[model samples]
Target chain A: MNLTIKATKNNTFDAVVVGSGMTGGFAAKELTERGLKVLMIERGREIKHIEGYDTAMKQPWEIEHRGKTTNVSAEERWANSRFWGLGSEEVVNHLTNDKENPYIEKRPFDWIRAYHTGGKSMHWGRQSYRWNKQDFEANAKEGIGIDWPIRYEDLEPWYAHVEKFVGVSGQKEGWDVLPDGHFLPPMPMFAPEVHFKKMMTEKLSRPVTIGRIANLTQPQKVHTDLGRASCQYRSKCARGCPYGGYYSSLSGAIPAAMQTKRLSILHDSIVSEIIYDEQKKRAIGVRVIDQHTHAVTEFFAKIIFLNAGSINTAALMLNSKSNRFQNGFGNDSDQVGRNLMDHQLGSGAMASIDGFEDDYVYGQRPNALYIPRFRNWGNDKQTAYLRGFGYQGGASREGWESGVNADGFGADFKKSLTKPGPWSIRIGGFGEILPNPNNRIYLDSEKKDKWGIPMIVTDAAFVENDWAMRKDIIASAVEMLDTAGFKNVTSYDRPTHMGLGIHDMGTARMGRDPKTSVLNAYNQVHDCKNVFVTDGAAMASSSCVNPSITYMALTARAVDYAVKALKKRES
Target chain B: MLGGAFSAPTLMAMNHWEQATSPTIEGAAFSLSDTHRKIVAEIAEMIIPRTDTPGAKDAGVPAFIEMMLKDCYAQSEHLSFTEGLASMEQVKFLELNEAERRGVLKYLEQQTKEKMKAMPKGTPFWRLMKELTLLGYFTSEAGIKASFDYVQIPGKLENIKLKPNQKAYAY
Candidate 1:
């Protein structure tokens, strides 16, 4: 078979955004909206907005496995196979197959990834929350890693800008710890959750509120105009919503970018390296390998945005070895892949409630009740831990799946199964992991993945601070459940591996000093000002919250700064 | 208002099923003899006996159980199942009278309780058999759609009080 050598003109665009996930989608939208012709590059195959959603409307009987994980899948998705419902027969497609997209793990880092047009945005939990002023000032106050260049006040307007377009469904509780956001009507809570909230407020002096999800409870004209609708409450969100019910790159930002006609998407183009010009001292373009053809192509742009997730973004920059950056592009400080962190989890409590037999719910609610971070804050500063943790969980009547363990069968068993079992509530705590420079990811120069790209070797692990936080996390959770009058309360502190939380952050952190960090305040590379990285890689600290909303906010904020810089240079 | 005809999870399940099994149909690999299948079917039927609703056999649960055991269960679980079955009365268990069959099952149930005390992981044959039977029966179309209530879409989520004799909606 003769493989013909193919080379074309340096594909030019005003801007190039790599990896069309949460941040990339926002970067494309913001850049294109600013009259810049942007080219969005995605390594995965293209999945058209609502039309590509295949499993959004399946019935109970229609499911073959009925949420059972198979032996084949267990062996294949070895790292993430334990993620309970994540292995459900439907949501499997959204996750990266561990066999194909392999990464070396010195320690057990559950590097879960979703490579597609929409990326993991199609399967995000959509738990949106704003970081308080305290979160930005924590590192500097505690003398941990480098301090964040920007504060909460700088990102507040950008958070609103992203929220208005994304249709955030949350209640505004004017707490200084977790800032309020522009919100649609909050999703109604379960009756048991309401009772638990009251109990938490009375006894624990804690605020328990509905999860600030990104799903639209009430679709504004902006969402509807993009062919998206309000939530249908099917709770099969991980399978991808056909209704465009939730905020995803496909249903939200990508379509908005395409509508402008200035945004062009190139799928199945795996970016190999950022092309840096030695004379210019700036990134001129990027070289990509065709996922199917194995042919290489170069695409040039005035500016480049690396939104290829945390680990991959760091790996790409580290792999881009140039004459000027022999160690790696943007590796002047040798901090390209240092300071890797994920939220420390796998600790919490569960209990069986006595009542709520008649107060049961019908549909699968797509959100959970969130108990915001209380420890290590004003009036509640804890010496046990430096940062804090938050809880995300729900209450429900045990369904037929619970019958897998119970005794009985025959007519009596069938009759008993017709009604619900004991009402049970479970909550898991997500704690902040301190950014340790030693906990880092470096590219394995020898081992290559299926794409011929160097496999990323993760040496990151949770430190003593993370373990200390987990102790408090379990204690606080047990206290709350016990105080709420829940019977048979049990607490658990399971072994949590890094990257299992899927909130990977702080590989190329943002800081004031160019010598300390790779990216500046505006997410621009200090060495090459034309390139910006607005994903989790820019995070200075792993705040105890889902970081997708923050990524959207930062991308929007960075685009404003980048576009203004480009304009100033032209003038 | 949940008026959509399609369900995302089911469609994804169907797609996954197609991809995983490929040309082979689900439950094709019974991994059990005809005699073994018959005994397994009878045991499953006895566990979920026919009353107002159809039994496990009628719902085609035996094949599902065999498939699940073969494909989903671990090596230790498989060993326990095969060993447990070998220990049972092998003289045409399915051919026995209903009274004798019930007596044998009752004896096995008692044996399981005694074995559970000594067995560390307690891969008690009865428990595994019962668990698989319930999972296979309840998830089947005959069990959920025919006997139980199944709403394709509830339109909007709401909490409702159920009257006496009302069946719980199958999710």
Candidate 2:
């Protein structure tokens, strides 16, 4: 199904954005807001903002299995079957069926995904934090991986810009480790969390504050103008917030992009390849495949933005082989799918508190208490690891789910189950996984997925640096809880494969030298300057923080640069 | 404020969840005999007997337990569970008085404690019966309304003092 010149001409736009997720949503908004006619091609089906959140309002009783998987779902979602609560009736619709979208794992890796319009933004943990000045300099100072082309100063204003629109709710602590952002009033912490925070600061000198979440506690004109409101204090955020309480691609940026007349979108369209013109020395357009019809179509544009997540974005570049990029698109250094990194989790501690028995919560607060990175900082430099880690956790009384193990039977047992159990607090560390060139993803041509594309084989694994940090993560957590006078403190460290954190980054890293990285300072492909990748694919190093907010900031900055470059050329 | 219910965006948002076929309904291969089903129901009621609030029987937990076991469990597991029930039937458990039935359940509970590692998330027969009863009773509409505190939308969030004898929040 080759397109004629007339049809190709009709399909042209000023710019094309691929894979509408966290970054693509912002890219479309930024480009279209600049009066550039942008076309967004999403492989997943379209879902409208508030209305698409079908399970958002569903109560536990409304679900057939009462928020657990049925026999059929347990088999269908076998890959993610071990992930508790993922196959529940309310939350399952927002996630991708792992059986359908298959990938090869050289080492055990969990490829959790959401392929709809908003992508995983619909189901993000919503813990937002900035990668501060220290984070940008860690690689250069340690001489580990290649230096990041851009610094925190380069993204400061862009962070402020996106945070204003995204409506982050956080406490502004003047710590150089984690920079402050433009935040709404932070959500209230639990009483136990408050007590724990006091003890932590007084004893351990670790700053414990409320998590800087993406949920809006107070909606400003910027958010309310887009028809989004404050969070409803309902903890069921993962099902997609009908009130537009928290930020997602569908609830925020995509709607804003569509509000402008310059933005057009096509759904169920997978971008197969980027059309690079050898003579023109730039990307002219992209070739797309219809997800259902298997029909091929080419849409011409002056510039292209690849925001198909980290691994998928690299897979696309590797698959888009041509005369200029025979190895892969702009993969002159063979770095299109290398240096893959994610935050090393699966290590932390939990304890039962003696107090807070008489205390209970009024609403289901969806946020957690954050103990920011204290190690390897100004006053507390650590020999255990190079970078540091932060803790995201909450303290609350144990609910009825713990009753399965509790001893009980008739009326007495039934009456006991009606009330809460012991007050327990749990915290997990999100430690930094260093960018090792050996920890990478390469496309397996021999094994094609259900889509007829090459299955991405993840050879990435946790290195010695990550393991060292994990030791600290567990030991530090136990020490803190024990010192705070908590009862029966227990630690946990499960075997975690990469991609479990879902903050996949550094696949197509941005470095100063074209010989070592795929993208440059402005998030553009080093050789193919017209094509940009502002997702996690462009990350040079894996900082110990949630990466979505950074992706939004970088996408906004890159779009600003790209639009100006286009204008300069036009003039 | 959900404004403009008839607006273009609202109309587009009407894209409901596509997969409506209940997984249990679509793939329920196991069926319990009437005698086996009654004994299962009696065991569930024994585990969570009706007090002031409705027990497992009133909450329609017997049916839920069967549905879970039928569709959710493997054929081998279903056979194993039914075979365990046959052992109880062999003892003429249904003909016993209430006190005798309670004593028999206490003995099975002790036996289950010793052999719990044999079955993980899926379970031994007595443990499975008890677990299913608790799960079905707690999550059902009857349990939520009568036994637990059902708050549809608590608009405010805070750490508050617990009221005496306060019911657990049905999340």
Q: Which ten residues in a row have the lowest lDDT in candidate 2 chain A?
A: A1-10
After superposing candidate 2, which stretches have Cα over 4 Å from the reference?
A1-9, B1-30, B73-80, B117-122
Query: What is each candidate's DockQ, to 2 decimals?
Result: 0.39, 0.43
- Candidate 1 lDDT over A1-571, as tens digits, reads 0112234633889999999999999999999999999888898877776667666677655667767778887777776675666665677767777777778998778887888888889888899999989899989998999999999989999999999999999999998878899999987788788999998888888998899999889999999999899888878788888888999998899989988888888887899999999999899999999888978899999999999999999999999989999988888888889999889788899999987777867777899999999998778978877989999998988877676666555678776886767789999999999898999999997999877889999998888888888889999999999999999999988876898888999999999998999999999999899999999999999899999999999999999999999999999
lDDT of 2 by residue, B35-142 (tens): 888898998887777988998899998999898887667765566577567666665568766665665666566556767856543366786787788889888888
Query: Which residue segments of model 1 deviate by more than 4 Å?
Result: A1-10, B1-30, B90-122
Clashing pairs in 2: none
State fnat for each of the candidate structures. Answer: 0.59, 0.70
Considering just chain B, what TM-score does every model have?
A: 0.73, 0.77
In order, the first chain's TM-score in every candidate is 0.97, 0.97
lDDT of 2 by residue, A1-571 (tens): 0111333458989999998899999999999999999888888877777678888887766777777677777766765655667777887877777777777889877677778888989989998999889789889999988999999999999999999999999999998888999999989887778888889989988898899999989999988888898888888998888888999888899889878877778888888889888899888998888878878899989889999999989999999888999999999999888899888787899999997778888878889988888888877877867888999898888776676766557778777888877789999999888888888888896988766788889898887778889999999999999888888999999888877888889999999999998989999999998999999999988889999999999999999999999999999
lDDT of candidate 1 over B95-152, digit per residue (tens):
5666556655655665567777897353866878888888888888788875556776
- Candidate 2 at B95: error in angstroms? 2.2
